[model samples]
Target: MPSFVSRIVPVYLRIARANRPFISTEGARRHIRERTLRPQPYGPPRRLRADVAVTVDHDRGWPIYTLTPRTGQPHGNVVYAHGGGWVNEIQPQHWALAAEIAVRAGTTVTVPIYPLIPFGSADVVIPAFADLVLANRIQYGEVCLAGDSAGGQIALSTAVVLRDEHQVTLPRTILISPALDLSLSNPEIPVVLPTDPWLGHDGGLVLGEHWRGPLPISDPRVSPLFAEMANLGPLTLFCGTRDILWPDARLLVDKARGAGVEVDFHEATDLVHVYPLTPTSEGRAAQAEMIAQLKTALETVRR
Candidate 1:
C-alpha cells in the first residue's frame, strides 16, 4: 500500500497546480518569462540541508554547483542535471538530493545549471554537458551521472554522447521518472494521464518542440529513447504508475536490456512522478538505494 505521504502528494499537486504552467503553451511561455526575468535562489524548492558545503562555479558560461560534505573529503564525484520539463530551473529538492548523495555516498556532486527552453535547447546543451562530464571524469578518475524527469533525459543523453561521440563509458547513470520520449506519443501515456496530476500531454508537446529545437521528435539527440544503447555503462531507472512518463521508462528498460546494456529499474507501483525526491517512505527507500549504488561506484573508484 502507498504510504500516507504518497497518497497525499497527488492531492497536494492538484491543489498547488504548480505544474499547471506546462498544461498549455501560453502558461509555459509565461512561466518561462517569469522565471527568466526574475530569477531567485530557487523557484519553489525546499531549503537545502546545512550538512554540506555548496559552491558555485562556471563551465562554458553555464553555472555549476558543487556540493561537498562537511564530514570529510569526498571519495568520488557525481554530475547531476535538474529536470523541469526542459523549462524549469533547479529546485531545492534537486539540491537536497545532490547534497544527500554527496554526504551519504561519500562523494562530491556537481550539478550543471543548463539553460531552459526558449533560451536553451538540446542542440546546445547536450554536447556542452557531455564535455563537462568528460572533464569531471578526467578530474575524478570516475564519476556517475544522475537526474530526474527531463534532467534524466539530459543525463542519459550526455552518457550517449560520451559513448558514441567522445568514446567514454560511464560506470553508472541514475534516472528518476525520466522523460525518455518528449514526443509523448506512447499509447500508455493517456492511460496514465488522468492519474498524473501534474503533466498534460498537450503542454508537453509544446515544450518538447521548443526544447527539441531543430531536431525531430524522434531524434536521438532530443528523445534518448531512440538513441543507440550499446557500449554505454550500467543504468538505474525509477518511475511510478502515477507518471505519464512510466511507459517510456518501461520502454527504455526493454530497449537497454535488449542491447545488452545492464539496467536496474525500480517501478514504484503507487507513487507519483519523481517520488524519490519527496519525503515519503517509498521515496526515502528509493533514495537509499540510489545512494548505495553511488557508493558502489565510489568504491570502485577508490580501488
Candidate 2:
C-alpha cells in the first residue's frame, strides 16, 4: 500500500540508514556536540539566482529574508520555517521551496533563519519566532504559517503561542509531515517504522527530547498534538502513510475536527516523509493543494 516514486526508493533508504545512528540517545548527544562545534554559515541567499525581489533585515531580533515575485503584486504573505529536525542546517531544498511558493502562489514568502537545538530551545526559539510571526502578521495583514518536519512543529507552536500569550491571530497553518508529538510514544508507530524509509522511531524521540529542553516532551509547547486544537488557525495537513509520523497526523486531525475546526487532510498511501517537498507527481499534487490553501487564506483575509 505504500506507493512512492520507484526511482527514489533506494535513495531514500540510503538516507534512512545515514540518519539512523542519530536515532539513539548517544547519537543525539554526539550530534548536538558536533553541530555546536561547526556552526554552519547561511551561505548565499538562493533567491539571488532568480528574478525575485529579495531583502534581508534583522528588524525582528534576527535576520529574516523576504522573497517576492517581480511580475505582480503578492496576494498575501507566508512565513515558512525551514525543517532540520531542530539540529541540522537549512537545506537548499528549503530555499528552493520558499521561492517556488512565492512564484506559484503569487505571495511573498519570508523565511527566518532560526537557531537550532542546543543553540536554541523552546524558551529561546519560540519567543523569537512568535515575534517574527506577529510582525509579519501586522505587515502582511493575513499571514499563513507553513513548514515541513521540525519546521512544521515550530510553525504550529509559534501560532499557538501568539494566540494564547500574545493575543495575535493568523489565517491558517500548513504542516507537512510534522512531528506533532515529540514523545513519539504512539502505540501504532511500530507498525510503520519498518516501512518508513527516511525516519527512525527511536532517533526521532531522542531528538525530540533534546529539542524540548526544559519543557516536558509532552508539553503543548513542544508537542502541538497535546495542545488544544481549537483556534490555532484553519489547518491543511499533509502526510504519507509510510511516514512514521502519520499516526500522529491522524490523531491531530481527529482532535482538530472534534474542536470544530475546518481541516483539509491529505494522506497519500506509501509516500515518503515531507513528500510535498519532493519533485515527483504526488509531491507536485501536494504542493498544488498547499498553494490552493494559501490562496484561500488570502481570499478569506480579503473578505
Candidate 3:
C-alpha cells in the first residue's frame, strides 16, 4: 500500500504530463543529465570497511570500491554501475545502495565508475568491467551484474558481451527501470504515455540527442532493444507503471521471451521512475520488495 505522501506527491506526475508530447530519446537524455547531474551534497562521511582502489585501464582511470563481509562469509559477487544517462559519476545514493546490498547479501560489491556518455561507449566500458571481474576472480562466485536506468543498460550490455565475446559466464542480471531502447519507438507508447511520471516525450528527446552523437538511434549498442538476445542469460527487470520507460520495459520482456531468454518481470503500479531514491514509506517498501526479488533471482542462478 502506498503512503499518504506517495499518493500526494504530484511533481513526478505533473512533470510527465507537461513534457509528454515532446519526449524524444535525445531529449530524455539531456533532461536527466541536466536535472540529476548537479553536484550532490557531501553526504555523511564514513569510510567503508571494504578495500578501495583505482586501476588504470587503456589510459583511463577506473575507480573500484570493494565491500566485503567482516566475518569472511563467502557469497556471490555483483558489479554495480551508477545511472546518470551514462554522463555522471557514481553518486552518494549509489554508494548507499551498494553498501546495503553488499552487507545484506554477504557478498563483495565492486562498483566501477564507468566513463559517462558524450565521452564513451558501451564498447569501451564493458571490456573495462570484464577486466575488473577477471582481476577479482577468486573473490566472488556466481557473478551477477546489476544497475538502474542507464546503468542497467550498461550491465545488460556487459553481460551480453561477457557471455558472447569473453566466454565468461555471468549467471544473472538485475535491471531496475532499464532504458533499453534508444529509439524510443516501442508500440506500447500510446497506452503508457499518460501514466509515466518522470519521463515523457520531451525529456527523452533531449536525452537521446546528447547520448547519441553521429550514430543512428537504432544502433544496437545505443539501443539494446535491437541487439541480439539469443545467448543472454536469465534476466530480472523491475519497473514502475508510471515510469516513462514502462513501454520500453514491456518491449524488452516480449523480445527477450521471443529470443528464448528467461525473464522475470516485476511491475509496480502508480510508482515513478527511480522511486527507490526517495525516503518515503512507499519508497522503502518498494526497495524491500526489489531486494527480495533480487535475492530470489540470485538464488535461482546459484541453483
Task: Give lDDT tens digits, candidate 1, residues 108-186.
Answer: 8998888887889998998998888888877876889999999999999889898998898888899999988888889
Task: For each of the candidates, give the backbone clash count.
Answer: 0, 3, 28
| Local accuracy of candidate 2 as per-residue lDDT tens digits, 19-111 | 653456777777778888997776436445475778888776667889898887787789998887898887777887788788878888998
Q: Pick by TM-score: which candidate is best?
A: 1
lDDT of model number 3: 0.67
The candidate maximizing lDDT is: 1
TM-score between candidate 2 and the true structure: 0.92
Candidate achieving higher lDDT, 2 or 3: 2
lDDT of 1: 0.87
Which regions in candidate 1 have their CA more than 4 angstroms from the true location? Answer: 40-47
Is candidate 1 or 2 superior in lDDT? Answer: 1
TM-score of each: 0.95, 0.92, 0.78
How many angstroms is residue 275 displaced in model 3 relative to the true structure, after the best TM-score fit?
Answer: 2.8
CA lDDT of every candidate = 0.87, 0.81, 0.67
Clashes of 2: 3
Ranking by lDDT: 1, 2, 3
